[model samples]
Target: MKLNYKEDWPLYLIVLGVITMIAKEAVEVVLTPSKKMTSETNKNEWHQPSLYLDNELKGADREMVLYGENLIANTSYYFGPHGTIQPITNGMNCQNCHLQAGARAWGNNYDAVFATYPKLRDRSGKLETIASRVNDCFERSLNGKAIDTSSKEMQAIVAYITWLGHTVKKGDKPPGSGITQLPYLNRAADPGKGAVVYAEKCQTCHGNHGEGVAEGSGYGYTYPPLWGDHSYNTGAGLFRISRFAGYIKDNMPFNQASHQSPALTDEEAWDVAAFVNSQPRPVKDISHDWPDISKKPVDHPFGPYADGFSEQEHKYGPFQPIADARKVK
Candidate 1:
């Protein structure tokens, strides 16, 4: 009866092994399906393609400064009805608050701002969308009421901001401490030639002397005085020819029809801006975000909104280039 104990032990061991295998299989059967389902669900989630990723998107790689310049040039969006939604300070447009596509001395730069959205804001006390951020500008910055979240004005501003975001590398912090770069003549600029272009292309609205037109029917200065006591101060922005040129190239004239009425070449815009700034205007010390003129950039009208050069670089040339220009000759 006690014989063959080893053979019986082998059979018992085989049974134990089979039970362990069955238990392991049971645990997998309970857990595997849910994990696979989760993996599948994750794969099914949708993601929108970034506009910057599109090679065909016009101005994808355009500099933020250039885009800001263009937005200034094509500024009709800020002034027209539905643009600001309310008149906070002196019947101003978004441009008045932003001061040239948000490129003014103390104004906030709209570019690369979207990257921070869906963020928790203390003021709102909750997560906000990029649209909410634009609305906030309308209420707080512009001192105006909020526009409908889905309205055209909101959309246009969004588009402009979106364009700005594209100029910066996604997920990267925006460069420069602030808009410290000074405006410089593009390689294509010819100021002398720009004068003739100014006379022919700009005089009608801006006046031969760059005096702004009257308000009201003409929509408050049919042409904003390029340089004058009432005009944007020397530090306010209109002082830079390249910045002016960029704005005129995109959005000049109160009406979109007028903006599209006669298209301007970048060279022509540069020329006209130069011609206008070359004219005499009362210089005033306007309050600026960066009080240290030495620290400011020439190309960036707004304190921290512009890019493309260093603070030292902005101060050495652009505005002070008068002396350098003499040396070149």
Candidate 2:
């Protein structure tokens, strides 16, 4: 009442404290880790079966499984799945070109690939979207025609790749997971030995000096330039011996029906990578997202489709909390 307004101060203070407590909890709930526990678990489960099946196969069945898995894994690169265009060089799958998701020393890998998609690709000065990015590989990498952006096969391949991308944090460089160890440069692999391997396994498509063949008149290079001026820029990954070795070990050559395709040992892959890198390539600035190079998650590496983190969070963060690997069961 009129007793004293000052005497009501403590009551007001208590009310303010209650309001603050509620607001804090509400914020916590809204910003709590986007629990993707199920998504992560599914990935682990999927990989286990593939590994187990691989271990169990024998004889022709083993060969069949390897071929099938190679096809499934590299569908985008070879079959023009995922809106790819090319399909001529080896008549094989993406695994054939990429070699186990590109595990060879100078091969391409799909890991940490999220950060590079949705890129502004310059195809003969024309700006292309991510769908076009997929198509470019079809045209150039597989020597096939591109797929329609809306195709189911393209969507499936994208889904598979997106699933794989989720294993690493976005923006980080791959740690050369599939790479093999090699001797020091002083004890470097004999490029002579590498030359023999290349002629027998690589020359058909990649050409004698790794100068990829010419497709139609002025179409993309039939075989991608391995180390020459037209090949990947000096700073564009394949320059790294380890990454190149990893790619060759996993993927390579044209025919992957037999693991005997590349037929190169880890040391062999490393030597080849060394030989290739030692060759001439244009030294250029290969721009990439830098500093915050965390492993990218699957799904979109950027844009509205990405999960958990906001564009700002994805770009700069308190990154997404590492899924509790221990909690995965």
Candidate 3:
């Protein structure tokens, strides 16, 4: 059959396009590795590892893991003022900060803890063991004394964290290992603006004064406090406005938000963080912190910095200037 070249051109082009697409896909399949291998290469990709206890662990190890999970989920029950084990920490569970016993993606999960500990940390300016790191949280975040490293509770917690990150290679930080790093705002975060946002969005769960709702039993908080004696101390990591802002940007207003669909804008997050941290909380003697003042984070919120910036500027920042200065140095 004699086909008219001009009239039949559209049909020929459509057929050629379809074949090209098929060929391209075929070539890609041949050239690219499988999904698993690609995921291994890009370790940051979300691979929601199951919390279900694996068949690999047996007997005492299994018991320890379960206990650790319980401890993380209900830390206040064992360490609060009315604790059955030891009345040490303010009545807030570890899960309040770590989220889902440190399993939730970008909710400050311990996905990289096992893989990355025994590494140098700028906060203390020392190579810290996982046990030392855990103790740091106890002292600062929980506003409590450090549990003995040899204690069963400490060992169990380490075991659980290790179990969570067992699959990840050493020094590899999986995506969503910690809170999302929100970008620095150009202007200083305003506490006044944040107060409004808190009243509208956060007050119901966290209370008007940031005193979280107490659990019915009065042992722990159902919603952890953001400030005051009961909350994380001034030396805590979240005391840093940037860390708190990043955390809030990724997860806040309870279950209404997530990293994939954050409820607040970067500006709102930063402002809210500023407001929250500006409120009074427990004061830790951080005289020993950041042995090398030059290595101190721009957002550390304390004085005696290598830079001439005031503590106010450090706490509620247009932080890029500090960052830029550091780069120049």
Predicted model with the maximum TM-score: 3
Q: Model 3: how large is the Cα RMSD against the reference?
A: 5.6
| Candidates ranked, most accurate by lDDT first | 3, 1, 2
The estimated TM-scores of all candidates read 0.38, 0.38, 0.86
Per-prediction CA RMSD (Å): 21.2, 21.6, 5.6
Q: 1-329, model 2: which lDDT tens digit per residue?
A: 55455988888888999999999999878766544543453333312123343454466554544443444455534453232444333232454345454333223445545445655433224444445655555544444556767865555455444434545565564443234333333243445666666777777878777777744534344456686644554444345555565566656654452222345676666567656766776554223422222333211124342234454332222222322321341
Best by lDDT: 3
**Total clashes in model 2, counting residue pairs 3 or more apart in sequence or in different chains:** 39
- The whole-model lDDT of each prediction reads 0.50, 0.49, 0.88
How many clashes (backbone N, Cα, C below 3 Å) per candidate?
17, 39, 1
**Model 1 agreement with the true structure over 1-329: per-residue lDDT tens digits:** 57476769887788899999999999999999988976675454222234456555564334443443443333334433333333321122445434445532213345445566667654335677877876654443233456676765456666666655554554443432113222444353455786787777667877877676655643334456665543544443445555555556545433331222436665566666666665655444334334444344354333442344444334222444533543454
The model with the greater lDDT, 2 or 3, is 3
- The TM-score of predicted model 3 comes to 0.86
